[model samples]
Target: MRDLFEDTATAFALKTDSELERAYFLFKLIGNEPLVRIGTAVTNFAIKANLPVERLIRATVFDHFCGGTNEEECLVVADRMFEKGVYTILDYSVEGQQVENQLDYTFEKTLKTLDFVKEKDAIPFAVFKPTGFGRFKLYQKITEGEQLTFLEEEEWQRVVNRFDKVCKKAHDLDVSLLIDAEESYMQDAADKLVEMMMRKYNKKKAIVFNTLQTYRWDRLDYLKKLHEDAKREHFHIGMKVVRGAYMEKENDRAEEHGYPSPICPSKKATDENFNQVVTYMLDNLDLMSLFAGTHNENSSYLLMEQMQAKSIAKNDPRVWFGQLYGMSDHISYNLSDRGYNVAKYLPFGPVKDVMPYLIRRAEENTSVAGQTSRELTLLKKERKRRRI
Candidate 1:
């Protein structure tokens, strides 16, 4: 086990003892409950004021989880990751801005991001959210299988056009675009849109990737269906699977309505489904490219074990790993050390506009069983090691 972990640690060449210590300390600070609560309060307050919370955010979540405040600023961090033999996936974190002009601005920013990626070869993926380009009500209609108003129907077309532009830009630039998954109710539209774009643009290479939230029971089955669909379409599938981000709200909404919850009934079920999906993807590595977006040590190690079982190479381009920037240094560094292709989801946006993202990170860290404790424990261990 030690040797395996050590081997995985080889990919992170940029982290010195000092940098690791800094990461440990940052995680430890964020894991503190009182600190998280205070940080959340201040950031939300700042959001209501429309003031830039960069300083407050930089001292809190962003300092741990993001690449930088903007694209230009992120290059230094991306360079560090490249120096360590890892890649960067730039994610634009602005969400819930609904005006049509705002959507145009968002689409332009996405194009600019793709242009930046073309100019910088180290960035492997450009990440965007569908909600960034479409109105929430329109997405709700699509997910509900309901008819849209005349205005909404037009807006929906515009949404599709925005995706066409983004996907075309990515295809032209020869970079991958990852369509991020949102809440379950809205996710169907995202999945369908990505499937459509992939069929159109992923003729010879994987230009569009869809994210699967394994915390939802339906997603594992959806993954199977996606694979079948891709086979029928005769195009490669790019998959990014995560445990999911909307647990509390998902369950609350399910209980509010009379519908059964889409999320797995228990943590055990979620873990089981996640592992099953990972194994299935590993078995079909020839036609699928996967990014396992998780921080669980067991899951990471098991992925490696499954790859070895199939006699797949450690650095197989079909398989990559990721943890959010600042959240799982150990996982990222260790996996990089093992000669695997690993990247960080490096979000960059104005702090006020990004508060929702920051708040969710706080909530997720709090809810994942023993996550805060684990982070605190690791920090203490590193501190003790330094003292010794």
Candidate 2:
């Protein structure tokens, strides 16, 4: 295996001590159980102090992982990543709200996000969750297998119109858009929507990408099936593979509902399935474009090995590597250094609004073994280098 420090050292060689300290602070904070448990309390206090939470967010997690709160704000970070030979994927992380005004606001934010990135060559993709700007109850209805009444169906058509506008804007300006994968219960609706959009927009080139969660055993096969469907439908298939984020919830619901859990039996099983899907997608590069989104060292290197084994170019246009903006610099920067297409999944939104995303990251580190420790080690080494 390659030395972990080598890629990181080269990538952040210009970072100052203050930057290193900040990175370390987030690393340790996210890893600490006690600190993260009291996060709401901390956020509440920060809000009460009338602190510029957005600025604090910008300086810390946002600075590390996302582009900005909006498209215009993203340019600074996007340009910087461009300088490092990395690309940016703009994610408008506005979710879990219920207000017509908020929902309309989300649609506007999404449109603005698309308009901003269309001109940037380095930003090859844009992503958003339908839940970000839509009703969760409606999504829940769709998830529970509820048939929409005619008016509800009309509202669904409006949702389609919204997508048409977004995809059309992206298509007119020549940018690819990705629909994120959500909870398993709701994923069917998301998948169907993306497939419909892909059929509508991915004729000449893939303008719509669907996220596939391989942690669910069904999705590896689903990738092949999606490709088959793409073939029959006569449009390109764009897919992003993640190990999945909602394992506990999926399992809990499975038990609560008396259904088989969809998660792979173990982490190894998930990794194996994920790598297999990567290989399958890469082998058929003519028909599909893929994003290998993971922070796992083995999974990332496995793709590199597969590319070499398959004689694909080191920087194949059909494949790219991705990790969340703040949490996986080691993976993102290293892949960029090695002449691979690498992009950080940079999410942007107001601090209070984006707390769910932030909290999930913190919880993920604590739950996933060695994630926080690996990050902390890198931050400390970089800090030590700065001190010297």
lDDT of 2 by residue, 205-244 (tens): 7778888888999997888788898788888888988899
Tens digit per residue, CA lDDT, model 1, 1-388: 4344333234234556776666666666566778878877876777787776567557755756777779998999998888776788888887889899988988888999998888886788888898888877788789899988898888899999999999998998888888888888877777788889998888886778888889899877787887898788888888888888888899999999979998899988988888999999988876688889998878888888888889989888778898887666667777776688888888988766676887877777866777767666655566565567
Clashing pairs in 2: 65-325, 65-326
Cα-based lDDT at residue 80, candidate 2: 79
| Predicted model with the maximum lDDT | 1
TM-score of each: 0.92, 0.93
Evaluated with TM-score, which candidate comes out highest? 2
What lDDT does candidate 1 reach at residue 60? 50
Off by over 4 Å in 1: 2-29, 32-35, 50-53
lDDT of each: 0.80, 0.79
Candidate 1 displacement at residue 188 in angstroms = 1.5
lDDT of 1 at 107: 89
User: Among all windows of ten consecutive residues in candidate 2, which has the lowest summed lDDT?
Assistant: 1-10
